[model samples]
Target: MDKKKISILNLAWILILTASLSFSGCRTDMQEASKTEEIFGTIVSVKAYGENAEEAVFAALEKAKELEKIFSLTISDSEINYVNQNAFKDAVKVSDEMFYLVCRADYFSRLSGGAFDYTIERLIDLWGIGNDWARVPKISEIEPLVGLHDYKNIVIDSQNHEIKFKTDTAMLNFGAIAKGYIADEMKSEILKHGVKSALLNLGGNVLAIGKKPDGSLWKIGIANPFNPSSNIAFVEVADCSVVTSGNYEKYFEEDGVRYHHILNPETGFPSKSGLAGTTVISPVSADCDALSTATFILGVEKSVKLIESLDGVEAIFISENGDITYTSGISKYHFKELN
Candidate 1:
């Protein structure tokens, strides 16, 4: 991918960069370095504060780019494409990282009862939402792909680190959760260089490490699904990841109907779960990223119940009418909705 400006219609989280750096007590003498690049199909930027900030941020971004080569669906030689092409004929051996992430994605698939299916790639291909040739498919075409969300059909061999598909037609897509894992890995890479404080914006998945140079929480604005250029709310957080998912970001319109990219594996269409957007907050970006997409498909009530059951995971759901609902863990002290 090529580095470009973040389009309002494509990102659901906006880092209030200037506001975050404006804390009164921030240390003025700390060294800082930042860089932005296009990777994982989104604008990824990293900023770090420390003596090694420059080297660390660059290394972290390089790590992200390297990971993308192994995971991206569109990359012709990626492990994902190799599996999709040949896993049905034989168990495909993969790297340890690939196996682990596949397992994590499988766990989320089971937890959401298939709402977070990674095997929904067939449907994603059919819709082709972000592609130039995107279109609405007939019910007949969508029917066969719906059952592909049966994630159990994806067989994993722990001993051999292989991935196999019981069904010939099934394909895997990690568009929802891979970025989170990548973000976490990038943070680890930064820490390895002795950087204590940093901020990352991978697409719209914002992860704050430690705190701002001023010892204040990072400010992240939740994009308004109805108005992508503005924020409906903002959160102050430290050492956490804030990820948002919505039907607004990627979509195609036909005959006055807008079809978004968050396809419901059950329906093989854009989710009609009555939620316009969902934002997940957690210390792990992978969980936040996975939960954001899954909960958006689960709708408000089920999402609320499910989030409450999980430890350290909180969610904010925005209704189709622009009303907001959140989990018990969220309070005005750290999270606030704008008028």
Candidate 2:
């Protein structure tokens, strides 16, 4: 062979090798790190993708623990406990995080017209819901607790970072929104660590950060209200949170009646609005969490109206008759019904 032909052949082979290497480097196949731990009375799973995935997942888990300490009502020395214990006596100073959460809780309470209230601890304790000794309280026992769950009585001073209660009977419980709050905070932490794609599943409250490694949306399943173990539908989402509030999650059956943990602040009993479950999808997990509960309590028509007025929020409501209704915004996404 001639020298010119040999040189040209060698150069072409080198170019092909270099191009292959460059293309492989830009491929979407990335490493994923996942961890699951029990936090906030539920299992929280964090999955991160990228070089710092492991570190990001662990950092998110730590953040969840830190927030749990601040929001847990039963924790002895927790910030919420201090506020609850000092109710009616004097204003109790709280951390900035606690104060901010309380403000958000109050806002949602007013937004739902007392449908989703944080100051329902008195009623919660009366019903013993989510407790080891959960039982069905008598009507006489529950009568006095009515009107005591008012969120208006609870005061929040953002300037001093303090919280006060008009009546000592006023107690705060963040069960409906705490997980969502933690998920948001974890997402922030993960992003700070340069993890672009992740999934935070705080029990049933799922938040998808960015798209999948392949750049596709995340598919989240909506649990079947009638069959707790199965899913009724799937919601494809990205960069958003999906949360559901259902009557079948925690409950005790007595005298052929099923009593769920989601109690109405007004009735001081399980809310019965013909809805078996309600799911909210939004950019903010905390907002989704609060709205899910409120929607379940408000029923289908009112919930749809409330979601339609809000921007960047969507909902799926499952009625007791197994009918499913979704907001207009959700029409953009694909929904696959399993049942």
Candidate 3:
């Protein structure tokens, strides 16, 4: 065969092989996988579409479960439990991961001025709203613990990754922020396995990475505080998290009075912010989670002020009377209010 003709034939074969590989890549990019597990006191789910989707989803869930073990106070051997037990006695050395989360939680605690405090574990235990022991506590019992919710009570040594309590009564609980952190971590793990698109619902918190398989924004529903089974509105978002904290999430009625889990550290009682629920949208799940709780406690006027100062963040507040208020940034989300 002529040399030129042979070279041309080789080039043709290379082109054909390249096209075949490209087709396969496109197919795998659209493959879908999903998984769900109960963790962090809620049902968490991971859904992804891309290469290694199944393995990635599985690994992501496992990673979140591992994190839960570290954060769950109910877990006797959890790092948080250890810190609460010994932090008052001596500086408790903790993993860098735990230290980092503690730092983030502390930041929010200060930022919200105790509205989103993690040191309110004693109050949480006293109310026990989510457990069988849920009830209202006496003023004497509440008075001592409310002051402990101050973030300054927990001391952090960033250099050595150690934590200590300035007050012996202070306790640490990451329940408000850990789920969002786990969702962020799960998104990271899924990306490590080459998934380009994923959605994570860590309980009511929703996180979307990239866009839908068809390149549309993810639509997340904001729950109606008055109607827990229904949505009050919906927001379309991409590459962000939508987290909601509401009085309806956990509560019990006593003497026709409702007591919720989101206690105001200042009062040692459920926040009476006149807002039934607050939903926050941000690029980071942890931020959205913490902000939702804080803004809910801050009420509409203060929340709007706080959210406006933040970049790439938006919030929606549903008042106890079904009035809706939101930040100016929320308009960009294509928000639709349902009647």
Q: Over the stretch 1-339, how does candidate 2's per-residue lDDT look in tens digits? A: 699999999999999999999888876558789999999889999999987999999999999999989998767888788888886699888887888788899999999999999988878888887787888988998887776646898877777887889976678989888899999999999999999999999988999999998899999999999997899999899999999999989998888988999988878889999999999999999999999999998889999999999999999999999899999989665766785
| Estimated TM-score for each candidate | 0.90, 0.90, 0.91
Where does candidate 3 stray beyond 4 Å? 1-29
Q: Write the per-residue lDDT of candidate 3 for residues 172-287, one digit (tens) a residue.
A: 87878998899889989998998989999988999999999899999988888989899889999889999999998888999999888888888888999999999999999999
Kindly give the stretch of ten consecutive residues in candidate 3 with the minimal lDDT sum.
146-155
Segments in model 2 whose C-alpha atoms lie over 4 Å from true places: 1-29
Instruction: Find the candidate with the highest lDDT and give its number.
Output: 1
Which TM-score value belongs to model 3? 0.91
User: lDDT per residue, candidate 1, 154-238, as tens digits?
Assistant: 8999999999999976888899999999999999999999898999999999999998888888999999999988999999998
Flag clash pairs in model 1. 26-214
